[model samples]
Target chain A: MTDEAVPSWEEVAHRYGRTIYNFAYRLTGHRDDALDLSQEVLLRVRKGLRSYQPGSFEGWLWRITRNAFIDETRRRKRRPTVPLPDDDRSPLGVAPGADEALAAMRLDDDIQAALLALPIEFREAVVLCDVVGLTYDEIAAAAGVPVGTVRSRIHRGRSMMRARLS
Target chain B: MTHPGDLLSALLDGELTPEEIGAVSEHLDMCAACRAELEATAAARTALRSLPVLDPPPGLLPGTAPVPRRRMLRPVWGWVAAGAAALALSMGLVLGTAAGPAPMNLDGFSEQHTARILVQPGVQAVRAVVEAP
Candidate 1:
């Protein structure tokens, strides 16, 4: 879409803010850090919009989001560690029939916990592949890796998750 | 028994070619181990899909008002201001030295004068004469 055709930042914020925020939160497991990371990602997306080619806006946005998270992780590594307090309030609380629905579909708390336990590389692969529903190629582009690497990582990651859950 | 670990992962990932799929299917008929692996992977992937799309904390969107550009620019301006002040002080030293006193070849005067020149603005203008043989 042309720059004009694209939704205004405010509109985009209104529409996709929660999605990006949740993605960051799940990736970071810290609300404050997730907020900061998501804001930074959006800021980069805004500045870099002109350069973004016309195609797969979601993919492009996700790439920016992924990079932003990686950069924040690196920055946090250099700084003194201040542990984020646990505030595990799921905005979408466990709903009625969720367990059964998830069972039929296969999503359970154990799976999520297993996912969280994977290494960052594996976790990211699983999140993008399974949770985000991105194609291997899209995940590779977003992750700045080869498609083969993405496939292998996703394979190994899923395998590890299965082992953990089992 | 077919090694379902390899084929199941490939199948789950949609990485298998049509021919590989046919081969896998044939193998699955004869191998209970491979069948079990396929079932497990399917169950796991299905479970993964059921994960609720988490809502990120408030205010994260592509078009959201950025950490105000002005806020980011503040540090840049501060650096510019500090640089400008340093330049002004240096210029003052050079100009002050040029406007004031002739240098004499005395030990204490040289040391004290050097210190005094450093403290004074516009002292650089006097540097040439002070160094002359």
Candidate 2:
């Protein structure tokens, strides 16, 4: 009934699909779980779009993504799987003659590990901000928290990761 | 001088208001400790952002242009057709088997034909003649 412009499901999938996948990947740290959550979110988006009022589409989509992730997490009856710390074989965490690509890959693994180690709340806030690139207000809307809380969580989340990485 | 605390992160993210940005900027200019904290926070934020944006498994989202038209359409109707064909084949086998003669129960012919004998001996005799094998 609303006259506001709404994107078709195909548009949403094409435009935001990568972001949603990365968001879930950063949150869950498992590729399969991320894929599952993305599909679930897309399905929800398709269903919800029928009744969706024109508003912050990003927020609505992220909220559905986040909810689907949480539901899946709960249904699995276990915590998110944490990757093991980098092995000592490389000793320096990088091997001689390794290319920049390998070095970057190792660094990425460390960062992903740090992300997985964070508490779920802070992790969500940080991923939504840095990875998903949502504004504080949008993140607040999606998270059902205040802007101040979002700010604090992002700050604390970064501090924790910094300490862990250091 | 009071530190901006979490506002430093807000400033890094460009989330602060103009006035807040001004205040935080002023603090950053004067406060070496806060500057250090800001640098570390920015490092973490950069690392998070630098983690590669992974692509979803190909063809994960249906009707997305990245997928070829044929691949997407194939699985659906292909599955339906395969399933329907299997179902039809199985149904045909079942109907054909039912229509064809059942293995004759030679062990207990009298018991098997007892109902027929009591109901219609004449019909059983005709069937016996027609079904001799």
Query: Interface RMSD value for candidate 1, one decimal?
Result: 2.8
Alpha carbon lDDT of each predicted model: 0.70, 0.81
For model 1, what is the error of residue B41's alpha carbon versus the real structure, in angstroms, after optimal superposition? Answer: 2.1
TM-score of chain B of each: 0.43, 0.45
Q: DockQ (C-alpha) of model 2?
A: 0.30
Q: Which stretches of candidate 1 lie over 4 Å from their true place?
A: A1-7, A80-82, A94-109, B1-7, B13-15, B61-133
Tens-place lDDT per residue, model 2, A47-103, is: 998998897677788889888877887877676555444332332345667798687
- Give the range where candidate 1 chain B is weakest over 10 consecutive residues by summed lDDT: B65-74
lDDT of 2 by residue, B51-94 (tens): 87676777666653454443212335644654675697677753
Q: What TM-score, computed on C-alpha atoms, does each candidate reach?
A: 0.63, 0.69
Predict model 2's lDDT versus the native: 0.81
Every prediction's TM-score for the first chain?
A: 0.76, 0.85
Which candidate wins on TM-score?
2
Clashing pairs in 2: none
DockQ (CA atoms), all models: 0.26, 0.30
